[model samples]
Target: MNELLTKLSECIEFGKINMASPYPPNMKGQEGADEITRKALEEGVNPQDILSLGLMPGMERIGVKFRENKVFVPQVLMSAKAMSTAMLHLKPHFLSGAAKQKGTFIIGTVLGDLHDIGKNLVGMMVEGNGYKVIDLGTDVNSEKFIDAAKENPDAVIGLSALLTTTMVNMEKIARDIKEAVPGTLVTIGGAPVNNDFCARIGADHYSPDPQGVVEFLNTKFA
Candidate 1:
């Protein structure tokens, strides 16, 4: 709500990484998320406020834009970059218990699926929304997902698959997690996936875009 936090939010929304990055011409040469976040910390702004008030709003805006088709992958990736740059300063606070995360989210592309753009975007958006993301990367198997769930009992598991062939893997993984760790939440998404597929696979939730995932998690944790 303050000036510095407002500027930080604007920088994140506009994809301004620093004073030198020129991806968004209107914000060129202006102090960006990196600088403003660091300065905010130096000036004693609460790190939680920087995240909740500054970064989350920016990410939420772009997320809504993405869902409405007002923005595309490249633009969303840029905002994610700015968010990541700013998070560098806040990570320490999160680590030291000075700031709190909403929950843990374990995500991966189902086995035999090498695509990551969708998974990565979801992870970034979830992280921006205050969840700690444990990315298992692409081509992940059921055992790995089960192991992660076992370790983080309360964490939500997210499965992604771009290929229709690989989408079947999600069903197996979801069943594996439910059998191994009952009550664990599993959400699925990708080009070939839909709400019907999610229901068929016994997964808990499904969404077409990253924002939908964020909203699902928020409701789960709310």
Candidate 2:
């Protein structure tokens, strides 16, 4: 069972989506995350174990690799796809209360930002790390974020901006959320955002990469 879990983690880390996926030349035709996760479940492995041992480790490895420039966006996206394939099998267990999540995360690409790649990457990374992510898609305004936070009171909010112009929107949204809902932690990220910007805008944190965001969430929840 441990062997299968290890193999499942390898499948995710290597971007093997299924037996037929051909992106990673060396891993061709091997049982990928999609198949291995189902097999592990059928073999009576606990869903939480598969999540923590198989999925999270793989994602962490890729996240670090991404931070180190060992891989790029296309590769990371493929790995995330592989991880999502495995997650589909575990999600029901999560919803049924048989498997536990670390916490809820509400995320958005603040209003005026149409770009979603960064937002999606962060969402997938957060989800892969065992947090339930509520992605309020691109051009998301403060009201939408507040509404989602109200529904999931303990959820941490992540605001992303790809453009310098959009960064101001993030500051506004953060202010609105804090004023309306005290104690709500707002984290910001983007190419243009930094710790100084975060502090100036009253945001709780700023991470340049998805892994940094995941680490912040882990510390906050822990």
Give the lowest summed-lDDT range of ten residues in model 2: 5-14
lDDT of 2: 0.92
Give all candidates' CA lDDT scores: 0.92, 0.92
Q: How well does candidate 2 score on lDDT at residue 8?
A: 85
**RMSD, model 2, all Cα superposed?**
1.0
State residue 124's C-alpha deviation in candidate 2, in Å: 0.9
TM-scores for every predicted model: 0.98, 0.97
The clash count of every prediction, one per candidate, is 0, 0
TM-score of 2: 0.97
- Give the Å error, residue 143, model 1: 0.3
Worst 10 residues of 1 by lDDT: 8-17
